[model samples]
Target: MLYRDGLTREGIVVDVIIVGAGPVGLSLALGLARAGKSVVVLEKDPGLHTTSRAPIIWPRTQEILADLGVMDRFESASIILKQFTMWNADSNHKLISLPISELKDQTHFPQILILPQHKTEALLYEALKAYPSVQVHFAHEVTGLSQDSESVRVRYATNGTSESEMVASYVVGCDGAHSAIRAALGLELDGITYPLMAALADVKLPYNDPNWVFPRLSVKDVPVVAVQIELGEWRLILPFTQDESITMDERVRLSVKNLFHQADYSLIWQSEFKLHQRISPQFALGRVALAGDAAHLNSPVGGQGMNSGIQDGALLCTALVKAIDTRNPALLQPNAEMRHAKINFGVNQFTNILTRVVMLSKGRYMPWVLRILNLVLKIPSLRQKFLMKLTMLGD
Candidate 1:
């Protein structure tokens, strides 16, 4: 439920204060609430994000949702993708296809689920309503944060007007890349910003191609990644050199036309974003911690960003619950270490390689690289390993 002014409970204590209401924040809140910890989620926005940002939920993240008992809700609303195909645009030749359905014996939700970020947040919010220990405060922007020996004090404003303060044992930041909490703590995210800009759009294609699930096509030197989200609607991502002269809409239209050979698709939403591969210097600073995009950001090539963030929430929530229950803040360090390592080696490194491969596909060494990749993918064991890595299940 949306919280208002009096819900702040100034002098009262809360176990945790989540500083964002996005998927990661909500997921962490839900998990903490289910664990019987008092949670207060503070969001700057008045409502859920409407546009589709992250659309692919991998197997590992689905497992986390299942454990939270919200997988059924997601399964009812999302589309199950059984396979991912890679193709050569010039020759229309299929390079390799990873059959996700083959892993049914290993996982309950073996395949990725294509659902918008907004829908995921809605489901998590609905699940949060079942727990009395959780309260989500919308339009409450966190302005100042300070902590002493006992608890963390968070100062926030309602609609940038009335101000208030609350105290929690710990504060978690699941905010996006420009996280206010992270900045307030003087934490630095160390990594490089890619020179290329990626343009993405959700559009309704004129034709339905059932085989279009997670297809990567290289057309005219541009790398196009397309996936059928639901029904005839598809999400396309294309990486290109930065061009300030061209408008995002024009670039998206041209890219779509070049990739699909059709300009009749109806555009639902479009955006252009710069890619970054970065991780926080530390996941936690005393009683304040970071999760989701606030802690790390990676390439969108393998759809790992959102999944990693959700996983971060799962891990952080568990640690927070344990720390609160045992009254030992030391319990939080293990999770911080584990998540930082995973993001550095597991998520960041993997996505960096994929992004480099896609970017290098426009270079002179791509053909040889593709040949080697095709050869390696021919081995059943190697293919399985690759699938596991891509699905974020390897680590």
Candidate 2:
């Protein structure tokens, strides 16, 4: 159960075998490599995604990127998010606008940045090149995972036919939801999947409004959130209540036009999915740990899922580097415990409440909830506290 001077008894060169090469896994790989740890990334996809998913990067995460030394490059490609506004869809009345500029005194990076998830992943991957110890294997899907007291073993298939094996001191899963690593470890998500089917789309609008996030609350129909991912490219998330439309393309257009009153916009890409407010009871089960969607699934209402995953990756990297350097096997437990508490009670719970609130369109409690929210949001002290939580400045 020892490091054998860096490699395992079977001559495995990697210190950590990271399953999945999304932002979380890549960030962890980059962090470990920067600290002089040998790591490998195994991704099921042939390459990085082309579309924009999970677009908002919070202030706290921006600081983490600065620590990793990519903020300068990231800031160039990303747009600053100015404010988030809530509105009544039925009457088009503005309820509140929370300006992100209010956090100027709290941190150097005061506002959130809007950059697509794919670009973030690519940046993290690019940063790993400075360290020669990192290895990335794409189209290599991890099929089985086994661990002993000393080391963990991973088996993955390349091109879906050829199989190979590798051993490491520790293995981490950033494989995302429906993770093969998590399933091989026999862990349960333990939460609720929303009953309504949700649809998300990225499109080109006729006009430019890149600073605002419009959350349209509806009593007559499902709720919608429309925000610009780039200069003129907006992303929309709403309930999918499709009828007998001839084509999905037509349905997407009809839905957006009905809700946003936009007469002309080109749809770039669209997808339908289900949201789950779920989490694993433990972040790590022995030496094999989980991060990102593999460990937790947020509602996507407040864009917390990817942020939480990136935070998880940074913490895991720090913990494992220390553990490997000092040869302390117990360091991972405390790291996992701290992450569980921080995310379970913080991001996971915060987005869950937001998801439920946005869906309460025609409920009887709407009047009471709005009255209380109006009174509470009027307090500067409370709003500051909320901004702290929303941006996760403390994490």
Q: By TM-score, who's the top model here?
A: 1
How much lDDT does each candidate structure score? 0.82, 0.78
Candidate 2 residues lying further than 4 Å off, grouped into runs, are: 1-8, 86-95, 206-222, 240-251, 254-262, 362-375
How many residue pairs clash (N, CA or C atoms closer than 3 angstroms) in each of the candidate models, in the order given?
Answer: 0, 0
lDDT of 1: 0.82
What TM-score fits each model? 0.91, 0.88
Worst 10 residues of 2 by lDDT: 1-10
**What is every candidate's alpha-carbon RMSD to the true fold?**
3.3, 3.6
Give per-residue CA lDDT, model 1, range 1-395, as digits (tens): 32333444344468899999999999999898888788899999998888888989999899999999999999989987787666655466776667887777768878888898888999999999998879998999999899875789999999999998988888999988999999998987899998778888888989765655555455554446567677888787767747567666766676566656677888999888889999898898788889999999998878988899999899898889888877777777778999999889999998999888877766334445666887887898988888888888888
Kindly report which residue pairs in candidate 2 clash with one another: none
The C-alpha stretches of model 1 lying farther than 4 A from their native spots are 1-10, 87-92, 206-218, 243-247, 363-372
In candidate 2, what are the lDDT values of residues 101-132, reduced to their tens digit?
88888887887788988888888888887777
Error of 1 at 250 (Å): 4.1
